[model samples]
Structure formats: C-alpha cells, structure tokens
Target: MKKYIVVALLCLTGLVQAQEALFSGQQVSSPQVNDDKTVTFRLSAPQADTVQVTGDFLPSVKVDTPMGKVDGPGKALLTKNEEGVWSFTTSVLAPELYSYAFIVDGFKTTDPANPFLIRDVASVTNIFIVSGKQADLYRVQDVPHGTVASRWYDAKTLGFDRKISIYTPPGYESSTAEYPVLYLLHGAGGDEEAWLSLGRTAQIMDNLIAQGKAEPMIVVMPNGNVGQDAAPGAGSDGYYTPQFMTPETMNGKYEAQFKDIISFVESNYRIKADKAHRAIAGLSMGGYHSLHISRYYPNTFDYVGLFSAAIMAREDKSGAGVYDNFEETLETQKDNGYQLYWIAIGKTDFLYEANEEYRAMLDKMDMPYEYTESEGGHIWRNWRVYLSEFVPLLFED
Candidate 1:
C-alpha cells in the first residue's frame, strides 16, 4: 500500500508540473498596447499556413451591400517568426473600444490569449480599448457607478414575465428622490441587455453624471420583440442562435404592448410618471419603435430621439392599431407639446432616404425638431456617439 501511494503521488506531481510548463511555455502576451499608442497582437500557431488580423481600427473599405455602399471591416496579414509565432502591430489607434478577430488559413477565430470579448447578435469578437479622449467614458472609472439590474416585469399585454434592464442613478438605492425616466431601446437582434452590454449605457451614464454633464435619471431598456419572451437564449428557447429579425418585429404588436413595460416601470420604481419627465430613444428597429410609440401614444414621451431609425410606414395601412393614423398621430404629438424631438442619422445609413422623407413630412407639418447628421452608416459606433451626446440634452428642466 505504501509503494502504491508513492507511485500515485509521483504521477500527480508530474501531471501538475506538466500543466504548469505547458501554460508557461506557450504563453505569449497578446494585445500588448505599446507606449506609442500602437497595439500588438500575437498568436502562436506554428502549424498554421497563414494568419491575419481584422478589426475596426483598420482602414474601412467601402463594400456594396443591398443598403448601398457601406464601410466594411478591413484585414491585415500578420508576419510569422522563426518560432512559428505570428504577430501584427497596428499603427497609432485612436482612443476607442475596438473589436477584432484572427483569420487563420481561411478560418476566423479569436485570440486564445485574450479572454475579453463581446457578442453582437450571433457573432462574438474579442475587444480592447485604446484609452484616450474618445474612450475616456467607456472604461469603468473611479467615479460612483449606477446599479444595472435585469428585472423581470409582468407584461400583461404580452402575457408573460418579460425581462427588462434598468439603470438607476448612483444614489438611487440610498436616496428618496423621484427622478425622470429615459426609455432606451436597442436595435433588431438586441435584447433587454443590449444597451447595458453593447451601448455601455451604465458606464456612459456614470461618467456623465459624475462629471455633472447630464442629469441623474433612470434608464429603462426592454426587449421590443413581442413574440420572444426575452433575449435569444434567455427566453423559453434555450441556447438558440440569435438572428437579426424575429416574429412580430414591425407588425405593430410591440408598440401596442409597450404600455405594459411603462406600467410595470411606473408601478414598481420611483419615477416622475408624467409625459414631461419621460424620454424615449432607440437605434435602428428600436428607433422605428420609438418613432411610432412616441407618436402613437401622444404626450407619453416629451423627449423623442430616432438614431439611424427605419422611418418607412407599414405597407398594410388599413387604419389599424399603432400603424393607423400616422400623420394624425404626429400632428397630435406636435400639438400636445414636447420638450425635444431629436432626429439623428448617419450620412451613409441605408435608411437615410427614409429619414429624409420623414424629416420632409415633419417640415411640411411645421413641427419643431433638432436634426443632427453624422458620418457613418447603420453601425453601433454612431449609436454610441449619439447616446453620449443625447443623454446630456435630456431632462435639463
């Protein structure tokens, strides 16, 4: 028994040493942000024939898509060394959060050395931040941060307990203040968690409030897809791949059922609960929802923002719920009075023409609004910039 025990101990010791050596031997520090504001990415794939890096930091090349010419991600080939290690260094990158992946001999993969990553719809990419003025608010600073909670609310209209992400100000838990509410919606293929994760809503809010650039308000993000109970894997469907479009997206169901979300928010949380103190904004499909919801239920949102929004009216306009009374609704919303109606879109956005038509309609009605056009297309980068700029303009009263 003593001899057997000694042998087992020796084997265990060898196994541990092997693991340690294996890790230490192949370990190469990737994503080395150098002193000159450049980034170095290294991958140890000696067996691979070719390796290349692709990221948003690279020069964007215009690609022809169905939505006109949109800027697509660019790639750069990495040089290999004697040790079979492939590496590529980027030129001075601006201070911003960038996502990248490695294409190894035609197969796309992420850096094994870097674990930090983010998911947009079905695609997952590794991310790193070049810290500077552009990304100052993207990181978690030493300032007081707000609490973000994934609360399950009763959606009576949808007949289910829907998931909603809420961001309360830093002192919300401790203070008795009734603050204004901002309903922040995500684009198609996004869920309640989209704004918090991709949009960096909490970080932006915390930094802005800490700097006294924006008012402290509660931000609510809800899943706009009425068919799905929650986000992709978060709903009754388990671990299913996320798609760009889901059932009941633009069929006027979500807009009609949106009141349940508002009701749940008002009843449960301490809010101003009035039109003057309420704001609504979204990107892409969510922007479509925002435009319709704000106008459909006139006087509900005093502040309305459409960020790269899809502005075309439904083809089936038989004067039914939500889609019914389009111009009449806008006129009512205009007459009911609003503090701000902000419309923002990218110059190359596919929906740019649609937005132009919508703006023309608004102009024809002599409706008051603030129009801001940016450079870029239907992408998250512009959306983030919009959010950073938009929140400061909300609830100044």
Candidate 2:
C-alpha cells in the first residue's frame, strides 16, 4: 500500500509539472467567453522567436481575425511580462469544434496539460464544443431515437475490413418491427466517422422526426476510395481504381470497405432487410457510389440521395466502379424498379456541373428524379440544409 501511494504521488507531481508548463506566462488561464460568441487565445515568445498555432481542424479565418476569435470579435494581446516568459491573451473564439497546437519558436506541439481532445491513434488534437444558438438537428428530442453503432465488417466481394457507422432512428429499440436502412457514404479521405462527427446527421433526423417532417430510418456511413480517388485523370500513379485493390493491400482501401459496410449494416441492424425499404445516399464520392450502386442493383434500394455528388461518368475508363455500362445500367434499373432519386448540390461545388448534366441525362432518359440547387458551396452548411429538407420527404407516399 505504501508503494502504491508513492507511485500515485509521483504521477500527480508529473501531471502538475506538465500542467504548469502549459499554463505558464499566460495573462488569463481559460479563454474568457465573450458576449459575441467567441473566445480568444494568447501566446508569447518574446525572447527567442515567433509563435503561431496550427491544427488539423483550424480553417483559415478572414484576415485581421485573431486566433480563437470569430470575425475578430475578440482580441488577444501578446507582450513581454518577464525576462523570458511572455504573456499572451486572445479574444474570444467561436465554439463548435476546434483543434490547435502551440507553435513555440516554430515548433508545433499539443498542450500536454489540457484534457479535452479527440484521438486518431498516435496523434491527438484538442476539441472544443461550445453551445450555439443555431438549432441542433441531431439533439435527442421527445421522439424515440436509436444509437450509433461503430464497428468493423468484412467485405467478401471487395476484400477488406471496413469500419462502419450506422445510426438507427428513434423507436428502434422498442419497436416490434424493423426499420428501413439507408446506406450513406462519406467523401474523399473521410471514413465512416465523418458523417456522425461533422455531418450531425442523426441529430438532423431527430429534429425532423420530432417535427414529423421525416420518418425514422437508419443511416449507414461507409468509407469511399479504392485508394484515394483524386482528380480523375491526374494519372494512374495515384489513381484509386477498381483493380488497384486486391486481397493483400490494406493501407489504402475503398471498394472493399464499401461492400462490407452494406453487408454488416443489414445483418446487425434490425432493419427491413429488403429492396423496397433500402436506400443509398452520400456526398461527393459517396454520392458517386450511390449513383453507381443504385443503378447497378436498381432493385436493391428504394430511395437514392446524392449531395454534391461526384458522378463523373468515364466512357473509356472501365474500372472506376462496379458498373460496366452506365446507360444500360440506369435503363435496366428504371425497368426493374425506381425509387425517389433526390440529388442536391451546392452551386459552387466542383461536382455541380456533373450533377446538372446528370439531371439533364436523366431528363432525356425519362428517369424520374428530384434535384435541388441551394445557396452555398460544397461544405457542411449545404449538407446540413440538404439533409434537413430531404429526410422528411423519405419513405413517403
């Protein structure tokens, strides 16, 4: 017992030292919240060199806008406090989710003392969730809601263990009947976690369900990319294609992950496991997949959604996806069965032209679809809006 006590003391001492290292020379400890909804951060490197903070999540703000401050609503001051220790104070920063690392003398490192963080293995980044006045679509409401299941599944056809995230809607737990499934996909470089973390899809469903705009349904987000599908013709050197993925390759995967996600969601979720109740949707690459998969199977899905969809049909290119003939594929699907083909894209998204062209092609082919052009770019704002409007229209007569 004495030995254990000594060890605990040592750990506590080390923790205190680390904490001191982080909080050193700061004018204010925790950044003060401002009335305008922002927080400021301060950093000082007076004696030695310059100081800057960078993070995986920090997008470039407008000029003159200080760190942690949204639109420069808050202010931070950096000045010399002592011989070497500098004092820095920041203006308020907007809260939602943010990650940052202190760049002392040009060295970037995470604050060791701060506990708030999100992990992706070896690397750790700070995250802050500030309450926003904007309505939250995913917040649990009075209506029954389902939980998100994060798991891995094997893809037999493509040959990979895909990480999958499925959001089962409210009333799923107690309902005697199974719910319909919507296989959702994420964009480039994003895995299954993208939709839940950034998209707030489940919350969007919750708000809509509570308001009676959308029926409760399951949403599955699968990874897209056989191997980082980049600018289509950037050259075969980095091109992620159908043949690129074999049973052995693991580091960069796409097709295999998608196949497994679908199979896993069907088996695991108490879903209406048939073609009539099944749907597919995604943004960017995921949108491309939805177009391909629905067109290929046709009868497998009853509803299809594409947000800022990357549906670039290459006539000469053979192995971008499972579909062989794009025209015949859609024709056969239209013949076999059709569902709600709803596609929404931002006016500024790179895929906007493709979306419009796809719509025109659909019109020529007499393929029924619902197309929406909203005000925004290919970002989360448009995605959220698209989801908010689209969900209520699902599973409807």
Candidate 3:
C-alpha cells in the first residue's frame, strides 16, 4: 500500500509540473498595449508554421465595387522567434473598440490570452479597446451606471413567452420619475442580448447620460425573431433554424407582434406612455421593422431612426409590403407631428443604395427628415456611432 501511494503521488506531481510548464505566465502576456499606442500580439504556437492576425484595423479591399475599398482594420503576418512564440506589432490604432482573431495555418480562433470576447449571431471574436479621446465614449467611465435586465414577458401576438432586455436609467430605481422610452431593436440574426453585448448599449447610454448628451430614458431591446422566443440556446429552442428565414418571418410577423412588447413595458415600468415620449429605432432588419411599425401605426412613435436599414419599396408576397399607399402613409405621418424622422448609413455599407432609394422617395414626397452619412461599412462600428449621434438628438424640444 505504501509503495502504491508513493507512485501515485509521483504521477500527480509530474502532471502538475507539465501543466505549469505548458501554460507558464509568459504566454499569457500577449496583446500587450505598448506605450506608443501601438499593440503587440503574441501566441505561443510552437508547432504552427504560419500565424496571421486579422482585425478591424486592417484595410479591406472591396470585392463588390471596382476602384473602391471596403472598410477594415487591416491584417498582419506574425513572425516566429527562437522561443517558439509568434509575435506581431500593429501601427498606432485609433481610439475605439476593435475585434480581432488569429488564424493559425488556416484555423481561425480568438486569442487565448485575452478572455474579453464578443459573440455575434454567426461568429465569436476577441475584443479590445484602444482608449483616449472620443473612444472614451465606448469605455465604461466612472459614472452612475444604469441597470440592464433580461426580463421575460408574454407575447400574446405570437402566443409564447419571450424575453427582452431593458435598460433603466441610473435613478430609475430610486426616483419616482416617469421617463420616456426608446425601443432599440437589433439586426437580423441578433437577439435581445446583441445590443447589450456587441453594441455596448449600456456603456453608451451611461456615458451619454453622464455627459448630458442624451436624456435619461428607458431603452427596451426586444427579440425581433418572431419564430424564436429568445436568443438561440437561451430557451428550449436551439440555434436558429433556416426555415425561419422566410419573408413572412422576416417582414410582417415582428411588426405585428411588437405591440405586445410595448404593452408589457408600459404596464411594468414607470414610463410616459404617449406618442411624444415614445421612440423606435433599429439596425438592418430591425431598421426595416422600425420603418414598417412606424408607418403601420403612424401615431405610435414620435421619433423614428433607421440605421443602415434594408429598405425595399416593393411589396412582399408575404403580405408585408412597405410601399402600399406609401405616399399616403408618409403624408399622414408628416401630419401627425413627429419630432424626428432620422436616417443614418455608412458610406461603404452594402445597403447604401437601398437607403438612397428610400431617401429619394422621401424627397419626392417633400417629407422632412434628417440624413447622416458616416465612414465605414455595415459593421457595429458605424451603428455605435449612429446611436451616439441619434440618442443626443432624442427628446429634445
């Protein structure tokens, strides 16, 4: 018995030593931000023949257009040293949040050294913030932050219980204030968690409200997928299936069911339930939904914003048409005394042409609206900028 115990102890010691040597703290010091504002990335891939870094800092070559460039962070190849560590240094990056991944011989993966990550609908990548001036807006500052709750509510329009993320201002819990509401919707393939995670909605709101740039209001982020009750894996429904990609699920269902979300919010929260205090805005599919919802119920929302919206003027076979009596709808909406009808899109966004067509229609109808164009493509970077700009302009008399 004594001999067997000794042998077992020796084996356990060897295992611990092997793990310590393999994951020594040296390899964990990757993604170090240099004093010059440039960044150095390292990976301890002793056997990897080739490793490359791809991120938003790399410049992207446009594929769809001739003589144009797609917006990207830029890519760089790493150099391996005698110690079997691959390293690469970047030029001074701009002050903002950036996501990146390392490709080892062809297999893409997040940095093991960096645990901070952002998961989108289709992919997951590591994230880092290069902070200084305006980039501070994206960072969590030393301010009284608001509370973000993932609350479940009944969606009678869809006949299932659904979840929505709501952000109440800092004083909401303590103060007896009835605040305005902003129905902030997410894009396709996203859920209630998307805006809070990748979009940094809470950080932006906290910073903006602290700086007095935006009013203290409640922001509701609802799951826009009509076929699914919550984010994939959050409920019994597994990952989103392909059958829900039809036009019926995409166009009409969400708009028809949105009233339930509003009713839930009004009944549960201390919100000023009036058109003048209600706002709706979304990105991509959510933008399309916002457009239709505001149009379908013209008096429901006083502020409407479309961020890189996928607008189609034609009628859908699914009975979710946008342009059926579109001129009359716009005329009636204009007569309803809305506070703001805003549209923002990136210059390199693939949906730029669609937004232009919508703008042209609005111009032809002589409708009053605000248009903003920024630098970048159809990425979260531009959407964040648009939100920052749009929130400040909301609820201001």
Model 1: per-residue Cα lDDT over 1-397, one tens digit each:
9999999999999999999867853488889999898999999888899999998888877878534676777999999999988999999988888889999999999888888988888878998888888588888999998999888988887678888899999999999999999999999888888888888899999999999999999999999877777887777877988877876667787887889889988998999999989999999898999999999999899999999998865653213477878999999999999999999998978889999999999999999999999987787778888999999999986
Q: Which regions of candidate 1 fall more than 4 Å away from where they truly are?
A: 1-26, 62-69, 315-320
Model 2 regions lying over 4 Å from their true place = 1-19, 22-33, 42-135, 138-145, 225-261, 314-321
| Arranged by lDDT, best first | 1, 3, 2
- Per-candidate TM vs. native? 0.93, 0.68, 0.92
Q: Report the C-alpha displacement of residue 337, candidate 1, in angstroms.
A: 1.0
Number of the candidate with higher lDDT, 2 or 3? 3
**Per-residue lDDT of 88-131 in model 3, one digit per residue for the tens?**
98899888888999999999988988889988766788888888
Worst 10 residues of 3 by lDDT: 240-249
Which sections of candidate 3 miss by over 4 Å? 1-6, 62-74, 238-248, 313-323
Model 1: colliding residue pairs: none
Per-residue lDDT of candidate 2, residues 1-397 (tens digit): 9999999999999999999766664443433345675544444455656655554224433333111122211122234456544344333444444555566676665544345654321234554444463334544456656688766666665544545567877777777778877777776545556677667787777777777877778887765544322222232344343231222222223432454556677687777788878778887667776787777666777888899887754332224455467798799888876668899987656566777888999899998888898754555556766777767777776
Best-matching candidate per lDDT: 1
Give the higher-TM-score candidate: 1 or 3.
1
